[model samples]
Target: MTGPTLLADLVDTSQRVGEHAGRRTKIARLADFLRRLSPEEIDIGVSYLAGVTRQGRSGIGYALIRDAQPAANVEVSELTLAEVDATLDQIAGASGRGSIADRTRLLSALFARATTREQEFLARLLLGELRQGALEGLMIEAVAAAADLPAANVRRAAMIAGGIASVASLALAEGAAGLSRFAIALFQPLAPMLAQPADDITDAMARIPMAALEWKLDGARVQVHKSGDDVRVYTRTGNDVTAAAPEIVSAVLRAQAQSLILDGEAIALKPNGAPYAFQDTMRRFGRMLDIEVMRATMPLSVFFFDCLHRDESDLVSTPAATRFEAMTAALPSELLIPRLVTSETSAAQAFYDDALGRGHEGVMVKALDAPYEPGARSATWLKVKRIHTLDLVVLAAEW
Candidate 1:
């Protein structure tokens, strides 16, 4: 029905299904109800499905659905079950090969079959998120209940349901009994991220198992959070900082992956677009309010060395090498870390010399297999730089 009503149904269904978790007979009954819906009806069903599924009683199975915007001609704000089901079928048929005409026809068919509530449900399903139950299994039950069937059967049936449209059709065909044999699964764990604290970078170093050190960059720390077509940038303080770095944000938005969060430093670049010194980038830091002045004075060039999340997977607990591989694969060539692998102290020293020759702060020597730990500062990293410091009797003290 409508987004709200369908959401309510999903919750009720999931609760019903939940009531008989291990009962295979009940689950089978739910499955049958899911089988009865048409492709268009399935489209309507998934909006509520997605909402309830997201709400903890279920998982993240709805990720397979490609979220779309509302129709240009429609004035309504939400979607219905049949509309959601039809949309899913259209998307499934379009997978890998479907022309614009095919998509248009699919939409037309959905619009024709979907009731007002179904239309609303379909709209939300296309968007891929429903604020309602939002749990996976629970939503499936809600769909079952909407069709006058047992919620218990649908819970297990979700596993073999394939996609929303598939589940809807099955529910319609055999009622509750049809839904008991699907393969729906729960959401994956949160993607791992390299931990860092707002209070101190050095503290983060202490948590690492191997050699870790401070990276003194006169630049800003950036956390790029991306989900589907949307990408947003945040500073170390978790403030939204995308407007100031549109170029970088656009670059990240164009990436081929599905979802991710990355960590790196963004420094200002020269007119020719070459990276400038760290000090030059410092001029633009913390100037979010005066974006125009900052943009004109110093633009940024981002360098990515670590990845926190990649395509629905967290990499925090993963070893550095593993995370590094993913980082290299996804990172653009122009913005990259100058990496060096060395097991020997002498080799590390040599690398340090080269880094200094290139005007870098120093070379960071890290243990080959260490997990990133945030908020601890210690020597899992060794930073070597060439500079002389001495107190030459106040040579000239001028304020």
Candidate 2:
């Protein structure tokens, strides 16, 4: 496959990207490398450029990498991308009993074969410290350039597709038309839409004249996908948390619609029907081992605020008002986040105060007609918090 490109090639490209002062040079270098990747190499190549492992994580710490003794006889271009990827996959997948030692041995073997430069690159790649200036944004630009597609189209497709690697492969192979096929699907997650922070309720309400004020709880953001008997819950970063939150699964199954994607938050509750502290909720959120046992004590609740898909139709393009309406129709009151629709500044302020009084973080003011813009933080959604933050200057630091 295309002369079996070496790990040295990518490392060399990354070095050049960082060394170049001009942005165009960095973009061009990355684009040239991206053009050489085959279909199977897209995910691995993209992950490397983004300073992460395609295998999620290597479970290799700095100490482990530090302990890996370097080799005497250097072979710079001997390690192929696929070969390195296979070794990393083994290390990441290692588990049970002596898995750590097994991983250590495997890592040692790889390090022993790697040249000094390749070993240094491997350490950075494993530690996610690839300080090579070209982050995912630049990677996206390079992908766009290599595929001969508009950057915006590539970005939008990447957002919907959930990963740039797949989008890149498609774009390179099928061009712009391939990227257009990405749509809202069950079990897959697009990056969650984020909001801007508002100084006060008045300013927040001013931004969206007729707005919807939803009680913003200090809880884990969830995107629920339900299709017939199948149900999945994902965190904001797209980690599946379905097994940890069973009540959420039941709630989705009871939803009126057969297939839909509902976005909301999951908060733990106390016996008194009040939400627990944010930290307390997190403990419950992260507990997968004794979830059933802990569910009885620190039971969690789901609150649906936005509907991304419904009745086999993608509603992300629809206005907030329409999506909220769909969410209302689908979710029972017990699972719905408390929301107030108003144009009055007084009402917005009152809602914000009431939310804080009820032990919530803040209130989210959303423009009624604003469409959900995934992977973006815009003024369409504003958070009005009770406590204000001060940006302090750091004049000195001590180690």
Candidate 3:
């Protein structure tokens, strides 16, 4: 489409994008560049501008990339976009006994052919840290501009698609129609909805009138997705921990729902029925082999707060209260977290006090009518917690 676009062009563009302080200028430059790239190259361009590699910091580390260097007078325009992509794929896929040596040889050859600028960019790409000021937000706007669609549509597609690469390619090629096809598939972890910080219940209540207050447990956040007998658990960062959380997996299998996605927290409890310390729960989380032994000693209990999907429906678009209702209807009472819907100041304070007294960190006050907004955080959901600032110096450690 544009003179068989070279990797140098991309490296040069990244440098230009990073130089500008104004966001509008960065968006304009990126959109212009995206328009020139072929359809196959759009995803790569998006990944570069968004400050990452498609390989995602695969096996290769910064030390490995730093040792590999190029000559002073190197070829600038020899490598094409597809050529660089293939080289990265090979480096990422290198495995087995002599794999590290093989990877080093591959990097040496690739860098030797690249110019100084290309080498610099490639090293950063492999290390997965493009210092370019342009990131996903800027890339989304650029993709929207290149595709001639509203930025909102592209952003929504990004949330469902789980990243900007596929969304960019789809938006640039097929526009809005391609984006519409991106939906929440079973067991595919969508980005978890996040919350904003609030000082206290009164301040939080002032932001949202009919707030849903739930005890914020001091434990790991979990997203449990169940499709019939199939169940999986994902951590806050969307890593599958189902095998590590056998109790949670079993509860989801036993839950009343057939098709559902649940958002919850798993807390380890003492024999006296009080919850154990957060650190103790994390120990159990890290214990892979001694799970059954730990279950007898320090059993973990899950408390689900939000239902993202249930019974062949995406419940995220519904009101928070509606989703909570579905969650109550499906899960056992022991599995559901303690929650209350109240606008009164006194009730909110009592809930807050009760949670802290019961070994929890604090309570989360959420808007009853608010839809689940993933990735972005706002005042719609407020977490009120007691703050204890610490300034410490590590003196010594036993090895």
Candidate 4:
């Protein structure tokens, strides 16, 4: 009903857990509420939801509208405290879009009639940290509670609404429970695993755990799924990217294996078959490029290490050696994953030494008996980087 309450509701509806239809219904409701509020009250609401600039500017209303338009090309960046204060001042004094008796009036009119991108920009300007925070969630809950609707129902309904504003509208009418009822889909078996910082070969080698080690190549982490002639390639984020790298996808399609998921590094290779820098491979990712130029500039070679799906069964729970065997059988190239046949730590160390001599990053020490955990960066498959450093602790205390 109020500006702050409306803003909060919009945020709640944007939560990924809700149903799309419900969220849309909520958005429509919020829009109706905005229509009832006076321009001045709306400005006050914007300022309250997102702190007003020192100059009294509340860009939240304008931002919200701008964000909804396809033609609205807006770039948001981090702002300093001083910048926030200045914008507030400028907004408070400026009058153009509508009759402005005050900052609140101006903001209300801006949001009420502005484009989607404008509204999005304004909301970000108001909320500060527009990417992630409690504002979106809290607003939804506040709105739902205000309307005396079961928050859970609203949240479920919100999934249909989609977008930040739609969810917010639901929250205004239904409350926090509405946002909570929706199921959030992560969609992938793997999350984005962070690479431990490895400056050089020695540093990577030292980090290697006491387990079976394979050379770590400089490449992009790729998950390849093959079911007969069909193939799927997923990046670390689980986004399907088979079309981006058709050659690699086709290679997986041609594999003799049926229904297998192989996790490995996809590297750009030189003409003589040497892998290029990691940056080179990154250039080809998610780009519309000429195939001939792409092949010439960034030829890729996927080095398989772990197998998840194998032979009509998910072999992720199987032992590392078993999975390795399956991976080896699925492809003919030794370059897939050059493994060593030695239980001895010294032998593994020797292999690591040899791999580095071939310009590899380092070795990944995997427990031979372990299962393939997609996203886990456990010590079971410890990554060893070759870097030299001492963990030196400060002897004295600092303020």
Query: Could you say which candidate leads in lDDT?
Result: 2
Per-residue lDDT of model 3, residues 80-118, tens digit only: 788877888998899999888878878877888788778
Local distance difference test, per candidate? 0.52, 0.85, 0.84, 0.55
lDDT of 3: 0.84
- lDDT tens readout by residue for model 2, 95-196: 999888888888888887788898888888888778998887788889999898898888878778766766888888888788877867788887899999
TM-score of each: 0.42, 0.84, 0.85, 0.50
Ranking of all candidate structures by their TM-score, best first: 3, 2, 4, 1
Angstrom error at residue 381, model 2: 3.8
Ranking by lDDT: 2, 3, 4, 1
The TM-score obtained by model 1 is 0.42
TM-score of 2: 0.84
Q: RMSD of model 3, in Å? A: 3.7
* TM-score of model 3 vs. true structure: 0.85
* 192 Cα displacement, candidate 3 (Å): 1.0
| Inter-residue clash pairs, candidate 2 | none
| Per-residue lDDT of model 1, residues 6-109, tens digit only | 33344345445546655454445444434443444454445344552212211112232122222433444244443344455554456334444455555555
lDDT of 4 by residue, 198-296 (tens): 443344344543345677887778877776777877787577877778778767776667677778878877777666777877877655558657866
